[model samples]
Target: MLLILPLGISYLLRTDGIATDKYIDDRRNYIEQVLDTIDSSFSAYEQLIYTTVKITEELAPDKAEHEAALKLAFSSSRSALVYGIGIWYEPYSFDEKTERFGPYIHHIDSNNNKEEITYFWNTPEYNYQNREWYKTSLAAKEGEISVSPPFFDSDYTYITFGIPFSKEGKKTGVVTVDIVLPQLQGYLSDYNFSDFSGVYLTTKDNSIVFSKTDASNAAIEKHAMEGEQPGLFTDRTAVYDENEITSFFEGIGQKPEILTSETENGVFRIHAFLDRKAIFLNIIFRHSLQYLIFFLFWTSVLYLIIFNSSYLKRNYENRLLNTENERLTEEIFKRKEAESRLTFQAYYDEVSGLQNLNSFMEKEEALQPGNDNRSLIQVSLNNMKELSLILSSTIIDETLLAFTTRLKSVCPLETRLYRARGFSFFVVYDDQKTGSSQKLAEKLQNEFRFALRLGSRDIRLRAKIGLVYFKDAESLEQVLAMSQSAIAGLDVADSGRVGLFDHSVQEQKARHVVLDAAMSQPGFISELYMLYQYIVKTEDRSPAGFEALMRWKSSVLGSTVSPAEFIPMAEENGLIIGLGWFAIEEVLKAISGPLKNSGLFVTVNVSPIQFIELDFPDKLDNLLNQYAVDKNRLKLEITESSAAAAIESFWQIIDELIRRGYRLAIDDFGTGESSFHRLYSMAFDTLKIDRSFVTGLNLDERNQEICRSLMNIGKTMGSQIVAEGVETEEEHRVLREIGIKYSQGYLYARPQPLSETEFGKS
Candidate 1:
């Protein structure tokens, strides 16, 4: 009996040890897999953040442009369920002087509904430059992604992803995406542990800890509390008390079998407890197991317990792994939802409930080749940005929405209207319903002529429309660009006017493109020289003086670049300032010989742009002094359209020129608005009648009346009346009958270069 007992004891101990060793290894391998999955899932989420940012920059570029869509990016994203996204912009984007703007903020409110917050002119003063993530990201390399430390807001734990924002291909801001994390302590609360073992995950650096309980219901009470969250702990000691720290060993009734693995700079460890009761049961039954009556039964029962423990160990490991996979699957699903929303918002504008710029581009790309009767109209609300400064953003948004309503009310059933960007709206229509562009523009104007009643404020609206007639199979970009460019070509005073795509503008654009490219060439400067034309005395066909006209005969262009083509372009691009300097220099060098001989004054046209330049007077003074030419003999023609704006602020320059004995003529006088105001207020050498009234002076009574009235105004103002564009002898005779002082056109002589200036003289 004694020998039997010893043999049985040896058998049981040997089997238990072997099984324990095998199961321990299996548990550890299982834990390593769980940790790897978590690390990979985190990396996947980070990639999702990058994807959202890239799409935003591609589609919206500027948040203020497609604000609704940006907010929808958060609301539609699976990430939004986990986190909120906000866009922070540079100061100049929204035109704020002191405070930076976060124009679109997509966040879950207290009710858990996704809400959008738009910040524009009325956004409160907050310096986003001082934010932690903002500073951190600015120091990071361009296009690099980063993660912020976990924090709590609205009782939800969060970690933020900071991404760079770019404008004009330069990084200017950051997109902050904040995600909510599950409460650390409660994450594993439902996990079940056997009497023989407990499982727990611990960080390698001892920063985070989570644990499952044993049969006693004892657990790690302070594994992840305020000590880890609010950062109340400095080191390991701060996380645990001297006696309570021993609870893991004390609660399990023995030193634990600890297993550890690494995860994202942290450790994931499991603590398994030894089953002393099972050991005691095995010992108590050892002597009885070998009895003759119960020998087979006892042996079968013993083997059963041994294999059952192994079974339980395997099942437990599988359960933990399953839990991890399920959680990761849920996260992946949410992330996909987020990505889909971003793509959808890519095509939709969330704020105004209209198609965005990206949608327009996509539609444009998708259009089929077919003959369709269509007219494209681009409407711009003039002074919208200025209005934002004066009125609240709420008011501006209301006005914009109201404007859309007005457009919808007047537009055809087949027409599609899209809010392009900012205050610009694009309308596409069937020509069968739209009639003519002029009628459409007039209808739109009349619709806006009445004030929009917004509570106590009756806000008036003013818009400039550009119309382009489309041809078969024309690309959307071509038509859209043509329409917008036509609008841009309108004179500043012509606001509320519809500029249609016309043959003249098309020719001008073709020449403008040619001139723009050629002006930068080395030959452009040498090609710029003055042509002299006769400013004839009215009674007899004789030259009284000469008007010096700057002409471009480009070798590369293979044609004469008209003043009508490149002059306005030069004024707009600030190239006219340089052109003015070049003209002054060349005219002085050319006419120094001519002026010395005839005492026949030469009038050179100067752009209004030159007067605004502080150095204009100095440049002109230096040119004249250098050549020693009389300033009176060098008259300066100021186009009436150019003089309208100049009459107020440019008077000092005008006075300086006049005081210096330089003559100033109002070129194309009667065609401009406020010509009479200029004629009455400013001192001038001549008021040249615009060519429109001059062409039909002998035929139309209205033209004759206008010419007579302008001559009387010139006489009263002590200014000379010069009739331009005189084509026939009859036109010249009528101008002479009206007592006009001077005339110039193709009548006496066309403007000929200094090489050909003596054609009429001979």
Candidate 2:
């Protein structure tokens, strides 16, 4: 009996410890879940606030439409949020004799002649200056938005999101909407988790935006509304008055954790006494379900002892026999009984009805890995977006399904197929011993190219294949990643041709990454121009005249690169904007100081796309004024084709440039869609004939006619004609005979370094 008592007591303690650990884990999980829920809800509130602000800033303002939209948002939101939307207008400051502060209102009634007046009945009581929301919103620049700390209002304290609506280039007024914390708390209270107690929402700044506990008294409310006190209180563990409120600042910037404490209302270390008792009594009293089941079994055994000994033994033996008989019966019927429980999930892709990611994973595990000679091929379809535009949704699905079916026929039965990501695929070759990787790539390309040709002419489908030799990989992930990198590199190279990866592919890929980063900066083009000046023109002169030619200086390869190389790269990556800005700024700066007193003009080439900028002319004017440079010393050169292509907007941009006292020239004339009609209609100060026509004028009759015609056309259009690319005295004489007085070429100066007096004698 003594042994039994001790063993039972030890077992009970062990069981209780296990139960306590489980309870703690469950409680921790519940707390984390509550926090996640609140964070997600708050994120939704923020998105809505930003969205409303953006919409209002765009709306045509009688303020009527914006007000109606706000009303709609307020009404449609979750009921627990007391004020879904509110607009705060900066009030007319009497002291400043201007509108410098704000008045919170539900709507704006401009027709009542209350444009600058704060409406008393419809507006909130608190002055806007006293609120942090107003200060923070105003402090933010135009297009900036912010969220303020939660505080109580005269009506009700709720968490609020603030959005500043300003004129396109100015930040002046703001609109703020409150999302009541009670609503979020109410939504969270619906959780039926057995372990969760309360949820708290705090900002990164450690201000509590929402909390379930009502810790406010009159003094606390006053302090909070006055924005004088911090949002959180600090303690290890505490209880207040007879209230069950438990809060503290324990784990601030990490995962939330449980904190145990015991203190009471204004004065009591005495709660520690109760904690000790709780620990002593309940520490070993906790139990698990398994222990409960064991206790029930022992109780049944004890009850059996009270019955007639022989009779009870016989009854137990009979019960054991019946249980054995039932076990045998279950074994006999097992297969038949389990028939209804079996199920299989259908594997289908929503877009193409191909096998999905889950199905691929299951099949991949079942397949045997390929041997040393095998190559894993990955195929990615290029220009999927263009394909989507040309083909209908139904046709796209049908085409993909058909393509997959065709691919299956070419693939071996053991070969696995998967639609990896959108418009991409992976095929592992188990039998690459018979063929080389290159040969396989060629065969696959030929077959797909043929298939795509048969489909449609309006859209073209091409495959980029990346292969990995399985021998180098220790894991599937590394092999897959290497293959993808190979494919991406191939896409960049050959520009529409199929590329094969080799030893030097890594260096090529790294070069591209560096190039992208360097080109993203604003000064890439200007730096390139400076390099060009240093290399091609050895002399450096102040107040010098020079023509700005487009050149590509690669950030990837720290050297002067060819335009043929980087121009395509710039176009592909949309770095043209930065490049254009750099060119214009370089030209302006050159003219500002180098040509200030030299009587020289700096000419720069401009692209058709540059004219689309609405503020381009204004920006140019600002730059010129800032440098105190003469606008007449700056000239913009545009190709004839570019000007003719966008004719309607062409004259407007050109007229603005001319009106600003800058010169405009039609470059590469007689080459692109340049005609007498175009020259007569459009205004330009100069016409530059193409080098081909100028250089061949002495030998070829056709070239001479073109040069003479261009000169005639320039004369009729009230523009001076310049002949370029003159290489010999004969060519120069031919241009002079054609009446092209402004001549530039190797025959004259070979575009020599612009000395300070290069254009001073002209």
Best-fitting candidate, scored by TM-score: 2
Worst-scoring 10-residue span by lDDT in model 1: 229-238
What does the lDDT read for residue 624 in candidate 2? 76
In model 2, the clashing pairs are: 90-101, 90-102, 91-101, 543-594, 543-595, 544-594
Query: What digit string (tens of lDDT, one per residue) describes model 1 on residues 555-622?
Result: 88888788887788776444787788777766676668755676677777888757756556777888
TM-score for each of the candidates: 0.41, 0.43
Model 2 poorest ten-residue lDDT run: 265-274
Off by over 4 Å in 1: 1-471, 474-515, 675-681, 759-762
- Report the lDDT of model 2 for residue 61: 34
Residue 29: error of model 2 in Å?
15
